[model samples]
Target: MTSDCLFCRIVAGEIPATVVHETDATLAFRDIAPKAPVHVLVVPKAHYADVAELAKADPALAGQVLAAGAAVADAEGLTQDGFRVIFNAGEHGGQEVFHVHAHVLGGRPLGPMVSS
Candidate 1:
Protein backbone atom coordinates (compact mmCIF):
# COMPACT_ATOMS: atom_id res chain seq x y z
CA MET A 1 0.00 0.00 0.00
CA THR A 2 1.32 3.43 -0.88
CA SER A 3 1.69 5.65 2.18
CA ASP A 4 0.37 8.68 0.35
CA CYS A 5 -2.68 7.15 -1.33
CA LEU A 6 -6.04 8.09 0.15
CA PHE A 7 -7.63 4.68 -0.41
CA CYS A 8 -4.54 3.06 1.01
CA ARG A 9 -4.89 5.18 4.14
CA ILE A 10 -8.53 4.12 4.45
CA VAL A 11 -7.59 0.48 4.04
CA ALA A 12 -4.81 0.90 6.58
CA GLY A 13 -7.26 2.49 9.07
CA GLU A 14 -5.35 5.76 9.02
CA ILE A 15 -8.55 7.30 7.59
CA PRO A 16 -12.20 6.61 8.22
CA ALA A 17 -14.86 5.83 5.63
CA THR A 18 -18.43 4.59 5.71
CA VAL A 19 -17.58 1.11 4.66
CA VAL A 20 -20.40 -1.09 3.36
CA HIS A 21 -18.64 -4.31 2.55
CA GLU A 22 -15.24 -5.92 3.06
CA THR A 23 -13.37 -9.09 2.34
CA ASP A 24 -9.88 -10.48 2.60
CA ALA A 25 -8.98 -8.89 -0.70
CA THR A 26 -11.31 -5.92 -1.11
CA LEU A 27 -13.11 -3.06 0.65
CA ALA A 28 -16.32 -1.38 -0.43
CA PHE A 29 -17.33 1.98 0.98
CA ARG A 30 -19.86 4.68 0.37
CA ASP A 31 -18.67 7.59 -1.67
CA ILE A 32 -18.21 10.82 0.30
CA ALA A 33 -19.79 12.78 -2.51
CA PRO A 34 -22.61 10.76 -3.98
CA LYS A 35 -23.33 10.95 -7.68
CA ALA A 36 -26.30 8.62 -7.25
CA PRO A 37 -28.46 7.45 -4.35
CA VAL A 38 -26.30 4.39 -4.00
CA HIS A 39 -22.76 5.28 -4.96
CA VAL A 40 -20.05 3.10 -3.49
CA LEU A 41 -16.36 2.69 -4.16
CA VAL A 42 -14.98 -0.85 -4.25
CA VAL A 43 -11.23 -1.24 -4.07
CA PRO A 44 -8.62 -3.88 -3.50
CA LYS A 45 -6.88 -3.83 -0.12
CA ALA A 46 -3.53 -3.77 -1.87
CA HIS A 47 -2.83 -0.57 -3.75
CA TYR A 48 -2.70 -0.16 -7.54
CA ALA A 49 -2.28 3.21 -9.20
CA ASP A 50 -4.94 2.47 -11.79
CA VAL A 51 -7.07 -0.31 -13.24
CA ALA A 52 -4.54 -1.11 -15.94
CA GLU A 53 -1.83 -1.42 -13.35
CA LEU A 54 -4.00 -3.59 -11.12
CA ALA A 55 -4.96 -5.87 -14.00
CA LYS A 56 -1.37 -6.18 -15.14
CA ALA A 57 0.09 -6.83 -11.70
CA ASP A 58 -2.64 -9.15 -10.44
CA PRO A 59 -5.46 -10.22 -12.71
CA ALA A 60 -7.09 -12.27 -9.95
CA LEU A 61 -7.15 -9.28 -7.68
CA ALA A 62 -8.68 -7.23 -10.45
CA GLY A 63 -11.42 -9.83 -10.85
CA GLN A 64 -11.91 -9.79 -7.10
CA VAL A 65 -12.41 -6.04 -7.23
CA LEU A 66 -15.11 -6.51 -9.88
CA ALA A 67 -16.76 -9.23 -7.82
CA ALA A 68 -16.66 -7.00 -4.76
CA GLY A 69 -18.35 -4.20 -6.69
CA ALA A 70 -21.05 -6.60 -7.85
CA ALA A 71 -21.50 -7.76 -4.29
CA VAL A 72 -21.90 -4.18 -3.17
CA ALA A 73 -24.55 -3.67 -5.82
CA ASP A 74 -26.35 -6.80 -4.69
CA ALA A 75 -26.28 -5.72 -1.06
CA GLU A 76 -27.59 -2.33 -2.07
CA GLY A 77 -30.50 -3.88 -4.07
CA LEU A 78 -29.17 -2.61 -7.38
CA THR A 79 -29.06 -5.94 -9.14
CA GLN A 80 -32.69 -6.15 -10.23
CA ASP A 81 -32.99 -2.74 -11.79
CA GLY A 82 -29.39 -2.64 -12.95
CA PHE A 83 -26.37 -0.57 -11.93
CA ARG A 84 -23.15 0.88 -13.25
CA VAL A 85 -19.64 -0.09 -12.26
CA ILE A 86 -17.06 2.42 -13.42
CA PHE A 87 -13.29 2.63 -13.15
CA ASN A 88 -12.04 6.03 -14.10
CA ALA A 89 -8.42 6.04 -15.23
CA GLY A 90 -6.22 9.14 -15.48
CA GLU A 91 -7.13 12.83 -15.39
CA HIS A 92 -8.96 12.59 -18.70
CA GLY A 93 -11.02 9.74 -17.33
CA GLY A 94 -11.96 11.80 -14.26
CA GLN A 95 -9.97 9.74 -11.82
CA GLU A 96 -9.34 11.95 -8.81
CA VAL A 97 -7.72 9.27 -6.68
CA PHE A 98 -4.75 7.34 -7.92
CA HIS A 99 -5.85 4.08 -6.35
CA VAL A 100 -7.92 1.82 -8.56
CA HIS A 101 -11.55 1.86 -7.45
CA ALA A 102 -14.81 0.74 -9.01
CA HIS A 103 -17.68 3.12 -8.52
CA VAL A 104 -20.89 1.14 -8.05
CA LEU A 105 -23.77 3.44 -8.79
CA GLY A 106 -27.51 2.79 -8.75
CA GLY A 107 -30.78 3.56 -6.91
CA ARG A 108 -32.01 5.71 -9.79
CA PRO A 109 -32.02 5.97 -13.51
CA LEU A 110 -28.67 6.97 -14.92
CA GLY A 111 -28.75 8.84 -18.17
CA PRO A 112 -26.25 8.62 -20.98
CA MET A 113 -22.92 7.00 -20.23
CA VAL A 114 -21.23 10.17 -21.33
CA SER A 115 -22.46 13.62 -22.26
CA SER A 116 -21.35 15.56 -25.27
Candidate 2:
Protein backbone atom coordinates (compact mmCIF):
# COMPACT_ATOMS: atom_id res chain seq x y z
CA MET A 1 0.00 0.00 0.00
CA THR A 2 1.29 3.47 -0.91
CA SER A 3 1.80 5.94 1.89
CA ASP A 4 0.03 8.76 0.09
CA CYS A 5 -2.97 6.85 -1.19
CA LEU A 6 -6.03 7.39 1.00
CA PHE A 7 -7.63 4.05 0.29
CA CYS A 8 -4.31 2.33 0.80
CA ARG A 9 -4.01 3.96 4.18
CA ILE A 10 -7.49 2.71 5.08
CA VAL A 11 -6.60 -0.80 3.94
CA ALA A 12 -3.38 -0.70 5.95
CA GLY A 13 -5.26 0.46 9.06
CA GLU A 14 -3.39 3.74 9.10
CA ILE A 15 -6.66 5.57 8.68
CA PRO A 16 -9.97 4.88 10.37
CA ALA A 17 -13.05 4.29 8.25
CA THR A 18 -16.60 3.07 8.66
CA VAL A 19 -15.94 -0.38 7.27
CA VAL A 20 -19.09 -2.25 6.38
CA HIS A 21 -17.57 -5.40 4.93
CA GLU A 22 -14.20 -7.01 4.50
CA THR A 23 -12.66 -10.10 2.90
CA ASP A 24 -9.30 -11.61 2.14
CA ALA A 25 -9.21 -9.76 -1.15
CA THR A 26 -11.43 -6.73 -0.68
CA LEU A 27 -12.77 -4.08 1.70
CA ALA A 28 -16.01 -2.08 1.84
CA PHE A 29 -16.49 1.14 3.72
CA ARG A 30 -18.99 3.96 3.84
CA ASP A 31 -17.98 7.03 1.90
CA ILE A 32 -16.91 9.93 4.08
CA ALA A 33 -18.73 12.27 1.71
CA PRO A 34 -21.57 10.16 0.42
CA LYS A 35 -23.49 11.34 -2.62
CA ALA A 36 -26.34 8.92 -2.11
CA PRO A 37 -28.20 7.53 0.89
CA VAL A 38 -26.37 4.26 0.34
CA HIS A 39 -22.89 4.93 -0.89
CA VAL A 40 -20.08 2.54 -0.17
CA LEU A 41 -16.58 2.44 -1.50
CA VAL A 42 -15.41 -1.09 -2.16
CA VAL A 43 -11.70 -1.48 -2.74
CA PRO A 44 -9.15 -4.18 -3.35
CA LYS A 45 -6.78 -4.97 -0.51
CA ALA A 46 -3.80 -4.75 -2.80
CA HIS A 47 -3.07 -1.32 -4.20
CA TYR A 48 -3.60 -0.56 -7.86
CA ALA A 49 -3.61 2.92 -9.34
CA ASP A 50 -7.00 2.51 -10.97
CA VAL A 51 -9.44 0.10 -12.57
CA ALA A 52 -7.47 -0.26 -15.80
CA GLU A 53 -4.35 -1.17 -13.91
CA LEU A 54 -6.20 -3.61 -11.65
CA ALA A 55 -7.92 -5.30 -14.54
CA LYS A 56 -4.74 -5.65 -16.55
CA ALA A 57 -2.61 -6.88 -13.66
CA ASP A 58 -5.09 -9.20 -11.93
CA PRO A 59 -8.36 -9.94 -13.64
CA ALA A 60 -9.45 -12.44 -11.00
CA LEU A 61 -8.72 -9.99 -8.22
CA ALA A 62 -10.64 -7.35 -10.10
CA GLY A 63 -13.62 -9.69 -10.17
CA GLN A 64 -13.22 -10.22 -6.46
CA VAL A 65 -13.44 -6.48 -5.86
CA LEU A 66 -16.61 -6.25 -7.94
CA ALA A 67 -18.08 -9.28 -6.17
CA ALA A 68 -17.39 -7.69 -2.83
CA GLY A 69 -19.22 -4.55 -3.95
CA ALA A 70 -22.25 -6.57 -4.98
CA ALA A 71 -22.17 -8.45 -1.68
CA VAL A 72 -22.08 -5.14 0.18
CA ALA A 73 -25.00 -3.89 -1.86
CA ASP A 74 -27.03 -6.98 -1.01
CA ALA A 75 -26.18 -6.75 2.68
CA GLU A 76 -27.11 -3.06 2.62
CA GLY A 77 -30.59 -4.15 1.42
CA LEU A 78 -30.17 -2.56 -2.00
CA THR A 79 -30.41 -5.66 -4.17
CA GLN A 80 -34.20 -5.89 -4.32
CA ASP A 81 -34.55 -2.21 -5.13
CA GLY A 82 -31.58 -2.18 -7.49
CA PHE A 83 -28.30 -0.27 -7.29
CA ARG A 84 -25.50 1.16 -9.40
CA VAL A 85 -21.93 -0.07 -9.31
CA ILE A 86 -19.58 2.61 -10.58
CA PHE A 87 -15.88 2.77 -11.37
CA ASN A 88 -14.73 6.24 -12.12
CA ALA A 89 -11.64 5.71 -14.27
CA GLY A 90 -9.71 8.95 -14.04
CA GLU A 91 -9.87 12.68 -13.47
CA HIS A 92 -12.20 13.20 -16.41
CA GLY A 93 -14.32 10.30 -15.19
CA GLY A 94 -14.75 11.90 -11.74
CA GLN A 95 -12.35 9.68 -9.80
CA GLU A 96 -10.98 11.63 -6.89
CA VAL A 97 -9.03 8.78 -5.34
CA PHE A 98 -6.30 7.01 -7.27
CA HIS A 99 -6.98 3.59 -5.78
CA VAL A 100 -9.08 1.06 -7.62
CA HIS A 101 -12.51 1.18 -6.02
CA ALA A 102 -16.15 0.82 -6.93
CA HIS A 103 -19.00 2.93 -5.61
CA VAL A 104 -22.14 0.98 -4.68
CA LEU A 105 -25.04 3.44 -4.78
CA GLY A 106 -28.73 2.93 -4.03
CA GLY A 107 -31.57 3.60 -1.54
CA ARG A 108 -33.55 5.68 -4.04
CA PRO A 109 -33.98 6.12 -7.75
CA LEU A 110 -31.02 7.83 -9.37
CA GLY A 111 -31.39 10.57 -11.94
CA PRO A 112 -30.14 10.46 -15.50
CA MET A 113 -26.64 9.17 -16.19
CA VAL A 114 -25.36 12.59 -17.19
CA SER A 115 -26.44 16.21 -17.00
CA SER A 116 -25.06 19.40 -18.37
Candidate 3:
Protein backbone atom coordinates (compact mmCIF):
# COMPACT_ATOMS: atom_id res chain seq x y z
CA MET A 1 0.00 0.00 0.00
CA THR A 2 1.22 3.47 -0.82
CA SER A 3 1.83 5.57 2.29
CA ASP A 4 0.33 8.67 0.70
CA CYS A 5 -2.82 7.13 -0.69
CA LEU A 6 -5.95 7.67 1.40
CA PHE A 7 -7.67 4.52 0.15
CA CYS A 8 -4.49 2.59 0.71
CA ARG A 9 -4.41 3.77 4.29
CA ILE A 10 -8.00 2.69 4.74
CA VAL A 11 -7.16 -0.68 3.23
CA ALA A 12 -4.15 -1.02 5.46
CA GLY A 13 -6.27 -0.27 8.54
CA GLU A 14 -4.11 2.78 9.17
CA ILE A 15 -7.26 4.89 8.88
CA PRO A 16 -10.82 4.22 9.94
CA ALA A 17 -13.63 3.97 7.41
CA THR A 18 -17.26 2.87 7.42
CA VAL A 19 -16.49 -0.31 5.52
CA VAL A 20 -19.61 -2.15 4.33
CA HIS A 21 -18.23 -4.98 2.20
CA GLU A 22 -14.88 -6.61 1.64
CA THR A 23 -13.52 -9.21 -0.76
CA ASP A 24 -10.18 -10.84 -1.42
CA ALA A 25 -9.21 -8.03 -3.77
CA THR A 26 -11.56 -5.17 -2.93
CA LEU A 27 -13.07 -2.99 -0.24
CA ALA A 28 -16.37 -1.09 -0.08
CA PHE A 29 -17.02 1.78 2.25
CA ARG A 30 -19.45 4.64 2.78
CA ASP A 31 -18.50 7.90 1.16
CA ILE A 32 -17.90 10.70 3.64
CA ALA A 33 -19.22 13.25 1.15
CA PRO A 34 -22.19 11.27 -0.09
CA LYS A 35 -24.16 12.28 -3.15
CA ALA A 36 -26.86 9.63 -2.70
CA PRO A 37 -28.54 8.10 0.33
CA VAL A 38 -26.73 4.86 -0.37
CA HIS A 39 -23.38 6.13 -1.62
CA VAL A 40 -20.42 3.82 -1.36
CA LEU A 41 -16.97 3.59 -2.85
CA VAL A 42 -15.71 0.20 -3.99
CA VAL A 43 -11.95 0.08 -4.34
CA PRO A 44 -9.21 -2.43 -4.90
CA LYS A 45 -7.10 -3.05 -1.83
CA ALA A 46 -3.97 -2.77 -3.96
CA HIS A 47 -3.40 0.80 -5.10
CA TYR A 48 -3.58 1.82 -8.72
CA ALA A 49 -3.44 5.43 -9.90
CA ASP A 50 -6.62 5.05 -11.95
CA VAL A 51 -8.93 2.57 -13.59
CA ALA A 52 -6.95 2.40 -16.81
CA GLU A 53 -3.83 1.63 -14.91
CA LEU A 54 -5.60 -0.93 -12.76
CA ALA A 55 -7.18 -2.55 -15.78
CA LYS A 56 -3.83 -2.72 -17.53
CA ALA A 57 -1.96 -3.95 -14.49
CA ASP A 58 -4.41 -6.59 -13.33
CA PRO A 59 -7.52 -7.16 -15.37
CA ALA A 60 -8.79 -9.81 -12.99
CA LEU A 61 -8.48 -7.45 -10.04
CA ALA A 62 -10.27 -4.77 -12.00
CA GLY A 63 -13.12 -7.20 -12.54
CA GLN A 64 -13.11 -7.88 -8.82
CA VAL A 65 -13.56 -4.18 -8.19
CA LEU A 66 -16.61 -4.14 -10.39
CA ALA A 67 -17.99 -7.21 -8.70
CA ALA A 68 -17.36 -5.67 -5.30
CA GLY A 69 -19.25 -2.52 -6.32
CA ALA A 70 -22.21 -4.61 -7.44
CA ALA A 71 -21.99 -6.57 -4.22
CA VAL A 72 -22.10 -3.30 -2.31
CA ALA A 73 -25.22 -2.32 -4.22
CA ASP A 74 -26.80 -5.63 -3.27
CA ALA A 75 -25.85 -5.22 0.39
CA GLU A 76 -27.21 -1.69 0.41
CA GLY A 77 -30.59 -2.92 -0.93
CA LEU A 78 -30.20 -0.99 -4.17
CA THR A 79 -30.01 -3.94 -6.51
CA GLN A 80 -33.80 -4.39 -6.94
CA ASP A 81 -34.31 -0.70 -7.62
CA GLY A 82 -31.06 -0.28 -9.54
CA PHE A 83 -27.90 1.69 -8.84
CA ARG A 84 -25.16 3.54 -10.67
CA VAL A 85 -21.50 2.65 -10.66
CA ILE A 86 -19.12 5.37 -11.80
CA PHE A 87 -15.40 5.50 -12.44
CA ASN A 88 -14.12 8.98 -12.93
CA ALA A 89 -10.72 8.80 -14.59
CA GLY A 90 -8.37 11.74 -14.18
CA GLU A 91 -8.43 15.33 -12.92
CA HIS A 92 -10.83 16.43 -15.65
CA GLY A 93 -12.94 13.33 -14.97
CA GLY A 94 -13.54 14.45 -11.34
CA GLN A 95 -11.25 11.96 -9.68
CA GLU A 96 -9.94 13.60 -6.54
CA VAL A 97 -8.30 10.56 -5.07
CA PHE A 98 -5.52 9.12 -7.21
CA HIS A 99 -6.35 5.57 -6.27
CA VAL A 100 -8.86 3.76 -8.49
CA HIS A 101 -12.38 3.35 -7.08
CA ALA A 102 -15.98 3.02 -8.23
CA HIS A 103 -18.76 5.13 -6.75
CA VAL A 104 -21.90 3.09 -6.16
CA LEU A 105 -24.85 5.45 -5.91
CA GLY A 106 -28.51 4.69 -5.29
CA GLY A 107 -31.52 5.04 -2.93
CA ARG A 108 -33.03 7.72 -5.18
CA PRO A 109 -33.32 8.68 -8.79
CA LEU A 110 -30.04 10.12 -10.02
CA GLY A 111 -29.52 13.05 -12.32
CA PRO A 112 -28.40 12.60 -15.89
CA MET A 113 -24.80 11.53 -16.45
CA VAL A 114 -24.20 14.88 -18.10
CA SER A 115 -26.14 18.13 -17.85
CA SER A 116 -26.42 20.41 -20.80
Candidate 4:
Protein backbone atom coordinates (compact mmCIF):
# COMPACT_ATOMS: atom_id res chain seq x y z
CA MET A 1 0.00 0.00 0.00
CA THR A 2 1.38 3.38 -0.96
CA SER A 3 1.59 5.81 1.94
CA ASP A 4 0.31 8.68 -0.20
CA CYS A 5 -2.64 6.96 -1.85
CA LEU A 6 -6.08 7.82 -0.50
CA PHE A 7 -7.52 4.34 -0.97
CA CYS A 8 -4.38 2.90 0.54
CA ARG A 9 -4.96 5.09 3.59
CA ILE A 10 -8.51 3.76 3.79
CA VAL A 11 -7.20 0.21 3.50
CA ALA A 12 -4.66 0.89 6.19
CA GLY A 13 -7.38 2.33 8.44
CA GLU A 14 -5.81 5.76 8.41
CA ILE A 15 -8.95 7.17 6.85
CA PRO A 16 -12.58 6.34 7.63
CA ALA A 17 -15.01 5.13 4.97
CA THR A 18 -18.49 3.66 5.03
CA VAL A 19 -17.55 0.13 4.08
CA VAL A 20 -20.25 -2.15 2.78
CA HIS A 21 -18.42 -5.41 2.06
CA GLU A 22 -14.98 -6.87 2.61
CA THR A 23 -12.95 -9.91 1.69
CA ASP A 24 -9.39 -11.08 2.15
CA ALA A 25 -8.33 -9.22 -0.99
CA THR A 26 -11.03 -6.61 -1.52
CA LEU A 27 -12.99 -3.84 0.19
CA ALA A 28 -16.29 -2.29 -0.88
CA PHE A 29 -17.39 1.07 0.43
CA ARG A 30 -19.95 3.76 -0.28
CA ASP A 31 -18.84 6.80 -2.27
CA ILE A 32 -18.76 10.01 -0.22
CA ALA A 33 -20.30 11.82 -3.20
CA PRO A 34 -23.04 9.71 -4.69
CA LYS A 35 -24.16 10.33 -8.27
CA ALA A 36 -26.81 7.64 -7.98
CA PRO A 37 -28.91 6.42 -5.09
CA VAL A 38 -26.58 3.45 -4.85
CA HIS A 39 -22.94 4.26 -5.43
CA VAL A 40 -20.16 2.11 -4.03
CA LEU A 41 -16.47 1.86 -4.70
CA VAL A 42 -14.92 -1.60 -4.82
CA VAL A 43 -11.16 -1.69 -4.44
CA PRO A 44 -8.46 -4.27 -3.98
CA LYS A 45 -6.62 -4.29 -0.69
CA ALA A 46 -3.36 -4.19 -2.60
CA HIS A 47 -2.62 -0.83 -4.14
CA TYR A 48 -2.43 -0.31 -7.91
CA ALA A 49 -2.06 2.91 -9.83
CA ASP A 50 -5.11 2.10 -11.90
CA VAL A 51 -7.25 -0.74 -13.15
CA ALA A 52 -4.97 -1.39 -16.13
CA GLU A 53 -2.02 -1.85 -13.81
CA LEU A 54 -4.01 -4.12 -11.51
CA ALA A 55 -5.35 -6.21 -14.37
CA LYS A 56 -1.92 -6.64 -15.94
CA ALA A 57 -0.04 -7.31 -12.72
CA ASP A 58 -2.64 -9.49 -10.96
CA PRO A 59 -5.59 -10.66 -12.99
CA ALA A 60 -6.97 -12.74 -10.13
CA LEU A 61 -7.02 -9.79 -7.78
CA ALA A 62 -8.70 -7.73 -10.49
CA GLY A 63 -11.33 -10.45 -10.78
CA GLN A 64 -11.79 -10.30 -7.04
CA VAL A 65 -12.41 -6.57 -7.32
CA LEU A 66 -15.08 -7.25 -9.93
CA ALA A 67 -16.62 -9.93 -7.74
CA ALA A 68 -16.72 -7.57 -4.81
CA GLY A 69 -18.43 -4.95 -6.96
CA ALA A 70 -21.01 -7.53 -8.03
CA ALA A 71 -21.54 -8.48 -4.42
CA VAL A 72 -22.05 -4.84 -3.53
CA ALA A 73 -24.63 -4.45 -6.29
CA ASP A 74 -26.48 -7.57 -5.19
CA ALA A 75 -26.45 -6.53 -1.57
CA GLU A 76 -27.80 -3.12 -2.55
CA GLY A 77 -30.64 -4.67 -4.60
CA LEU A 78 -29.18 -3.46 -7.91
CA THR A 79 -29.00 -6.94 -9.44
CA GLN A 80 -32.67 -7.06 -10.38
CA ASP A 81 -32.82 -3.86 -12.35
CA GLY A 82 -29.23 -3.29 -13.47
CA PHE A 83 -26.13 -1.41 -12.50
CA ARG A 84 -22.94 0.17 -13.86
CA VAL A 85 -19.41 -0.69 -12.88
CA ILE A 86 -16.90 2.04 -13.80
CA PHE A 87 -13.16 2.29 -13.38
CA ASN A 88 -12.00 5.77 -14.09
CA ALA A 89 -8.36 5.87 -15.13
CA GLY A 90 -6.01 8.84 -15.33
CA GLU A 91 -6.96 12.47 -15.81
CA HIS A 92 -8.67 11.96 -19.16
CA GLY A 93 -10.85 9.28 -17.65
CA GLY A 94 -11.84 11.49 -14.72
CA GLN A 95 -9.93 9.56 -12.08
CA GLU A 96 -9.54 11.69 -8.99
CA VAL A 97 -7.73 9.04 -6.98
CA PHE A 98 -4.74 7.04 -8.16
CA HIS A 99 -5.71 3.80 -6.46
CA VAL A 100 -7.77 1.58 -8.71
CA HIS A 101 -11.47 1.29 -7.76
CA ALA A 102 -14.67 0.11 -9.36
CA HIS A 103 -17.65 2.38 -9.01
CA VAL A 104 -20.81 0.26 -8.72
CA LEU A 105 -23.79 2.45 -9.41
CA GLY A 106 -27.51 1.72 -9.58
CA GLY A 107 -30.73 2.04 -7.48
CA ARG A 108 -32.40 3.97 -10.30
CA PRO A 109 -32.23 4.49 -14.04
CA LEU A 110 -28.77 5.64 -14.95
CA GLY A 111 -29.51 7.45 -18.19
CA PRO A 112 -26.42 6.89 -20.33
CA MET A 113 -22.99 5.38 -20.16
CA VAL A 114 -21.44 8.71 -21.09
CA SER A 115 -22.78 12.15 -21.72
CA SER A 116 -21.53 14.60 -24.28
Which stretch of 10 consecutive residues in model 1 shows the poorest summed lDDT? 107-116
- For candidate 4, the per-residue lDDT at 76 reads 96
Give the Cα-based TM-score of candidate 2 against the true structure: 0.95
lDDT for model 3: 0.92
- Evaluated with lDDT, which candidate comes out highest? 1
Score each candidate by Cα lDDT.
0.94, 0.92, 0.92, 0.93
Residue 76 displacement in candidate 3 (angstroms): 0.7
Model 3 Cα lDDT, one tens digit per residue, 21-60: 9988899999998988988999999999999999999999
**Local lDDT at 2 for model 2:** 88
Clashes of each: 0, 0, 0, 0
> Candidate 3 clashing pairs?
none
TM-scores of the candidates are 0.96, 0.95, 0.95, 0.96
TM accuracy, model 3: 0.95
Worst 10 residues of 3 by lDDT: 107-116
Which residue segments of model 2 deviate by more than 4 Å?
A: 114-116
Candidate 1's residue-wise lDDT over 1-116, tens digit each?
Answer: 89989999999999999999999999999999888999999999998999999999999999999999989999999999999999999999899999999999999889877322
